[model samples]
Target chain A: MAGVRIALWDLPTRIVHWSLVVLIPFSWWSAENHDLERHRWSGYAILGLLVFRLIWGFVGSSTSRFASFLRGPRAVLAYARGSGDKRLGHNPMGGWSVVAMLALLVAQVGLGLFASDDDGLETGPLNHLVSYATAETLTELHELLFNVLAALIALHVATVLFYLFVRRDNLIAPMLGGSKQLDAEPAARPTMARPLRALAVAAVAFAIMAWISKGAPLAW
Target chain B: MRTRLIIGSVAAGLASVAMAQVPSVAEQVKARQAGMKSVGAAFKGLRDEMSGTPDAAAVKRHAAVLAGHSSKVGGWFGASAASAPGVTTAALPAIWTRNADFRKAASAFDVEARKTLALANAGDMAGVGGQLRALGGTCKGCHDDFKAKDD
Candidate 1:
């Protein structure tokens, strides 16, 4: 039997994910309640988390790379057929969902940086770049996307539950504990410490995200 | 729209005469001060009537004052938008390029302002708050797209 010996999540990656789970809802609540200061700061934190994840996915570990989980359409289709095939880490569908979620989040957070609440007391950091008409459209899009993300999240949770009950799989446990013991080889293991090279990459990505969230300075 | 523009221009001209040279920042400060004053007086009027029986005349007075001042507020910005470049203001390069969107937002504010006036005239305090909330939304809508954050 394949024992769960590898570490799937590094310290930084785990920290980023849990922080985001808390921050996203907090930011949304602040926005709705017209808590400008808290909303802006929460948004900054989200941007930081996203940036860190993007970097970590690249060079942190073997399983974290896009190449490992991002499969061809044919492979994805085969996996969907209940072929009893499994991935040690992210399966193809889950991988694509991750990409979609990241893209949507980036757009949402980016537009919010420039949003104004009309009361002179609140505005996004980059609101100065666009025309009022453009801002209106962006704001509307951002609001609509929130609903879309919520629906997607529900779907994702339902799928996980389906896997647990019907497929007899425990996907959530792996994510929580960063380990999965399977009776198979070629499975993903977690990383305890990210290499210095990976750390440097993560720092660069964080700087880029911070710069973008701050309205790229020159554009400001 | 044209009439409001004229009134705004006239008021702006008169306001400018009081100073040697009214900087854009100074003009903005003056406009904000006036807005605060008008809102304060209206809120006080609202509070005073809470203890009394429903008064139609008082309602009309409140509606008229709000509509007038709101229009002037719109005009103040409209005039400023028109005359901004003359005063060396780096308001945002996109503001001039995408003037149509700015105008649309301004027009939208005027439309909502009129709607609020109609509701107030009809003595529908029950509905005025909702309408005002929607009106406030449009203001943010425009600002998000066109205006830069306060420097």
Candidate 2:
């Protein structure tokens, strides 16, 4: 069957995904170099991205929505059995991996908000909210969670490679270009969520992040 | 026969003396960790206070505590506990492998801490902040090569 290029991932979804791809490793590098200033900025960016993704999950385009991808056990089983649809968006098994990645990222950023370096010099923006001992514990948890996130990310890349090679699917290409080759035009062209709405959501996310970075003063 | 017995007795006596000098490994590890925690706590206190309205008296107190801990750091780290059985520490083997450099780092921290105390006493808050960063850099220098990484 001849496949036609059709719209798939919307602009916001593609932007968010690509931004995270860059930010995650950059966060790791900053931490490794003891560049707390850079690390903190990266953390703020990640938090903003996560916030946007969470909101977008509810209201973004069809392929980007949780309701569209998250499926029941039967669906997952069917997917495992190689009987599920593979034309576009997240496959059933892949949906859970997406959720897990998002959940781990949330935990990582949340812990980072209260973490401090061993010397007590480099601290999270909201480190003031917790006691010193509590901050230390959060720092430890933050370290531990990064390990988990790194492991999941390795798994994610390996899975994508598996699809690329074994399954003969080019998952990476669509994420970059925002369209998939479908045998027929999608029954309904994906509802590309409005750019104005994405901008509004992004503004809210960055505002909240900036406020927190300032220790979230009570005066305002 | 008498000479042989006398030499054996002397060696046995000296062996006991040497054994006595070797401190309890467990206690050393615990005490070393306690020193680091106290330093960390004091440093954290000073940092937190600086973030807002700093109490001069408290700044002096925290700086004094930091100085006290820094002075004792070289001793705590002098003896390697990396190979102690049934005990665990984040101190990497390099702390001992590069022993001279490790001691130098510990000395640098001590110098910085004493200077920090002097600044606090002078009520030079800005100077104190800059010194804190210098002090932290000593920590980073040591941590970079000597300490195990978190991630």
Candidate 3:
């Protein structure tokens, strides 16, 4: 059957994905090189992206919503046994991977807010909210989570490559172009995501980050 | 007249010896590393004093030491110091390539260090603490750009 081309990812989702692709490496470099200012800003940017994604997951297109793809364990097991190929959005297994990645990212950035390096010169803006000991513990967790994130990113890339070459599915093109051609009937035709709503959500996320950055200095 | 000539000759010899004793690139690197270690120690001492009932005298002493070391930081990063062969140093080639930025970072550190010293002398422990953090940031800024990754 001739495939029908349909909209899959929204502009906001595409932008967030690409921005993360660039910003994650930059964040790693800044941290490794001790460019604490850039590192901190990058963390905030990631936090903002995560916040936007969380909001988008709720009010986005039908395909982008968490309810669409986050299937039960039985569905994931069925996907693992080779039964989940005709869907339009994320496959059941891929959906869980997405959730795992988002959760890990949230943990990483959340710990960073209270983290401090050994010299105490470079620290998270909200570092003052906690005791030095608490900050230090969070710092350790931040470092550890970075390693975990790195490993998970490697795995994610490898999975994408496997889908591209072995499964003959070019996930990246659809993610970039926001549309995919399917050989079978599309699972569901989702309306385009609302860019204005995305803008409003992003504004709210940025404002919260700014307020956190201002910090409670008197608490320190 | 003969005594005067002898004294002049002796002075010229001493001057030649001083010129001949100029440190090698490796020696300069080592000297700078030592200087930075001392600065770190002094900064730590000042930070420790910030805890409770700060010793104003100790604060002044440590801050003065930090300022003294900060002033010498730029001089220590000589052109050849980064390229010195057979030396195990964390100094990266960017220090030479991005000379202007490096110098700016170093000078900013010096300015912050001096400010910190003034604050310490004025018995403003809180101000000193804040300035010290800024001073350390300048150091980190330069190191991030110019120092090779140890890991």
Candidate 4:
């Protein structure tokens, strides 16, 4: 049962992961209580974090990059049939699920930008740019998209549990601690981008988010 | 005697048909929604106007709209309207069961709305802003118990 411990991911990835874990619930609570001010801030925070993650997917670390996990459909099929190569990172199928989750989250935040409540009293920061009819429609879609996001999150958890119990893999611990218990010590240390680089990416993400929160006007 | 009896029966049938043509619960719900939206828009408009050096006429118009809608807020909700089957609404069943409390909230809202309009008419923008906050509280108080959550 004992295994070698190997470094699996960078700290930025772990922070982004856990931030989502907190923000998702906070978003729900704010909306349920009709606290639109808090809800808007929550959406802005999510928007910033998602931007960071998307950028990190390109340039942060090896396992965090899309190139490392993504495979063609044929590879996914082979994985499903239990014949694909086993890697330390996400299996082929999980690669696409991660992409889907990120895509849905992005879409959800986009819709919230233009959404207006039934009475038009509460509105997103960008609601001023759209017609009332369009804002209302986006609001409906915003609610609907949240449900879709919820479903995907449920499936995501189910899969994680399946791996934890049936496959006897502990995926959660590695995510938290950034190290994995492996059968053998990895031969090469996975290279992490400099912390400065991550700070640069985060700065860029949150700056854009802050601008949008101010209604994304040219003058502002 | 036979002719008179026949005429009475026809009259009763016609009255029953007329009753059936009256507004259904769904219609009431729709009107209630429209009225509520109008009131909300008025409140938001007033707040926007009050944010700067307000045009007194604009403030008066917005305040009047709120006053008018708030006065009718009572008729917009009813025993038949709350949680009516096949009706889509944010109204909770508690609106009917807690009738006395709901009425009190509506009355408070109506009082604040009228006071706001009067202040606007007197060119008292200072008073209008604070009054609306009190008005907002009544709205929140009712919504907390009587309305379903937006989520």
Candidate 5:
């Protein structure tokens, strides 16, 4: 059974995850403290990570697919009932939560690109296009959603803890190590593709994200 | 025909009265120039201290100046508005269109700047730094919304 289970989260995913854990809060703190230099760099790093994760969700691995784990009502219900296979990757409901978190975070970071703290001291690069009223509204909404993200993160942590204690699942460990110890089973798996392919995908995503973030300026 | 003539006369009288009541561009310009001069001088004083060469004892005196003149700046906004009929100051149309928001920005600045001044006077560098940031935020904030961009 152990031999059958293939590596799911490749090295890039691990780097992105751990980097995000450090960068997200640091970005928030730097912005809050008016550390403009740090805030700007943190924002760029976030944009990079978000882009990488999106690409990884598509062509990276089977376990990483939106199609693989993003399931319907029955799947979620089964997951809630705790009868589903505790596979090597995200369960259905957890997959959707990941999607939601990623979407919200993307929005938060995207809006931050256009928001100004109303201080001429720190205008986002794209603030030039938006009107003052619109900019102010966006800034407020961006901040308000930060609190919402924090709540969602807390709920995520709580769920992980609950699963650990109640369901005897080591979800966090799998995230950290990219492997889960499952019960006795039959072996059947395929080899993961080359890391260079993953790196190439990441490069493409980064380029696309960079282009979109620049407002596709030449198109205008 | 007689009723029509009478109505025309009445309309003319009211029009003349309204014209008499309105202030001209020159009058408005003069008022804004005066207000800007006074406020600009006060700000210059603050800038001097903030240039990283502040005298601790002078902070108290300067705080009084900022406190006294902040209301004066608030009053100037009104006076300038009354005088300048249509010139776009950094003051947003929302100042008049959404009066509450303008007031909030102004009020917040006043409160925070005072707190900043107090912090400076106390020689609480960290507290003063935070308050200064807050004050700067409010100032830039109101201007960004209400005032026109420099362009």
Candidate 6:
């Protein structure tokens, strides 16, 4: 059925999503090739992006907010049963998937901060803060978690393909164009994303990243 | 006296024959590998020490060892050494294909290693740590471009 195209994603969210699409692979390549410096910096960028996303989830556009997408278990069950609310933002299952991915990414990046390799050449900036055993443990977790993330990413892509071909929902277009053509009026109408707020949030994220990179000194 | 002269000449010929049995390329590669292994061990030792009590003297010793190894790293990758295949090595063919870039990376690593050594000798653990990070970056840069991935 024909429907009006309404805004579904903000510019900042789209930028973050596409940038991640590029940077994630870049991170893997750098790590695989032993380009630890590039890998480390990519990780830092990911962390910063994640931080901005967390903040934007609250202060960003209507469709981008966590409150707009996250739903109760009942809603997810209903969606599974093919009887769910038609919404503009993420569906129930998709919402939870987003949450899961974000949580995993946070864990991965957090563990990386304390990780060290056997070569003794490359290490996290804050590796000195932890004991050798702790660093080693975190390093192991970091490696293992990447595999988990890779699997999840594969699943995510598969799901997106399913929506595109089977469900006839062009999810990629909405993400790229920041709007989706819907059958009915969007439940959550588009609102100003407040680019200034996003900028402020990004500044804070960068400051935190800079401090962490600088060994997170307690005092000046 | 003639018999004694013949025996001496035979012994000298046997020694030269034994030396020729070992190819020069193989010998060079072996020596280079040994030097790299020593550098790796020294780096590991430094990290282990830093992980514990941060001993300035021990760090200095290991850093000096690294610096010494770094200086010889360039000479180890001779022209013949790249083409000759004898022992198992992670060195990729690109090291020879991009000879100038590889040499630049090696030289950069040497500079960082020397800086790290000086910092360690000064007992400046913080400075040493910073230099170690840079040194590690240089090492990774070369490895990324030149070293083959372990399967």
Better of 1 and 6 by TM-score: 6
* Colliding residue pairs in candidate 6: none
DockQ order of candidates, top first? 2, 4, 6, 3, 5, 1
Which tens-of-lDDT digit does each residue in A150-208 have in candidate 5?
A: 88788888989989999787777767887655454425332354789788988887887
In the range B49-92, model 5's lDDT, one tens digit per residue, is 55355666665565565566565555445533643556644555
Tens-digit lDDT track of model 2 for B42-125: 887788777777888999999999998888877786663546778777788888888898999989999999999999999988
Model 6, residue B148: C-alpha shift (Å):
11
Query: CA shift at A127, candidate 5, in angstroms?
Result: 1.6
Q: lDDT by residue for model 3 over B64-136, one digit each (tens)? A: 9988888888888877566666888888887788889989988998999999989988999889877766877
**Top candidate when judged by TM-score against the true structure:** 2
Per-residue accuracy of model 6 over B17-121 as CA lDDT, tens digit each: 977764477687778877876776677667766655688988999899999889877778877677654567777888888989999999998998899998898
Per-residue C-alpha lDDT of model 1 across residues B1-151, encoded as one tens digit per residue: 9999999998998887855344465577466556735643443343234323436566557556656665554445544444433454324545557777766776676677677668778888755555655666665666677656532
- What is the fraction of true interface contacts found in candidate 3? 0.19
lDDT of 1 by residue, A1-220 (tens): 5343556655566666668778878987987776879998898888878777777677766666677778898887887785645556677788788777777888888788766554533557666566545665676777778887777767878988998999798877767777666555454344444567667866787787778666677643
Give the Cα error of residue A215 in candidate 4, in Å: 3.5
Q: Better model by TM-score, 1 or 3?
A: 3
What are the lDDT scores of the predictions, listed in order?
0.65, 0.86, 0.81, 0.84, 0.68, 0.82
In terms of lDDT, the poorest run of 10 residues in model 5 chain A is A182-191
DockQ of 5: 0.09
User: How does each model score on TM-score?
Assistant: 0.57, 0.82, 0.65, 0.77, 0.60, 0.66
- Model 5 TM-score? 0.60
Candidate 4 residue-wise lDDT, A1-220, digit = tens: 8768777878999999899999988998898787888999999999999999999999988889999888999999999999956576788999899999999999999999987655444678787666655666788898888889999999999999999999888889989999887777666656778899999999999998998887787873
Of 4 and 6, the candidate ahead on lDDT is 4
Candidate 4 lDDT by residue in tens digits, B31-83: 88888877876776776676456788989998999898888887778665665
CA lDDT for candidate 4: 0.84
**Any runs in candidate 5 off by more than 4 Å, and if so which?**
A1-6, A185-187, A212-216, B1-151
In Å, residue B143's CA in model 6 sits off its true spot by: 10
**Which scores better on TM-score, 1 or 4?**
4
Error of 1 at B76 (Å): 14
Residue-wise lDDT of candidate 6 within A101-162, one digit each (tens)?
88899999898888766555778878767765677688888988998998988999999999
Lowest-sum lDDT 10-residue window in model 2 chain A? A182-191
